[model samples]
Target: MCSNLQKAMIDLIEVFHSYSGKEGDKYKLSKEELKTLLQNELSGLMAESKDPAVVDKIMTDLDENQDGEVDFQEFVVLVAAVVVACHTFFEDLDKGNVTPCSRS
Candidate 1:
């Protein structure tokens, strides 16, 4: 049986592949693919951003190789960062530094 962590890793790879290879470079995510992935899979994150150029900014930051596309390594960096951010948010919430109802 796959452990929960293993399953999560598989899901991450699967999700990346599902959104990649549609336009160019079967192993990398094009800007459009990244945009679609963000809109569909990370809608909450996307919605939380007020900047209209958020996608562009993310692309610039994530394309570490200046390749104009996000490969699995770069993609993993983004996922890790988000996971850490969520962990921090929850830690803050637990410490009463963040109110859960602040959004509502």
Candidate 2:
């Protein structure tokens, strides 16, 4: 059985791959491809202020080896960061600290 973290990482990778019509294939996303995917697929999930720069920053931070691309492991770390940020945002909302609104 995989650990929780391992499972979450796999799930994130599957999501990334599924969007590319290449699920369960041996593939690693180049920087530009990953940026496009994140912008198109994750924009709704992220803040309205999210743009290419935001994605680039994320890629830079997560691409630990400075490879200018993200492997599955790097993508997993990126997903985890987003998950944590979202959780914190929701927790703040639940505390009556902030109101949530749709960007559109």
Could you give me the TM-score of model 1 versus the true structure?
Answer: 0.95
TM-score of 2: 0.70
Q: Model 2, residue 79: what's the lDDT?
A: 72
Model 1 has an lDDT value of: 0.95
lDDT, residue 54, candidate 2: 75
The model with the greatest TM-score is 1
Error of 2 at 16 (Å): 2.3
Per-candidate local distance difference test: 0.95, 0.71
Worst 10 residues of 1 by lDDT: 95-104
TM-score of each: 0.95, 0.70
The worst-scoring run of ten residues by lDDT in candidate 2 lies at: 18-27
lDDT of 1 by residue, 24-88 (tens): 99999999999999999999889889999999999999999999999999999999999999999
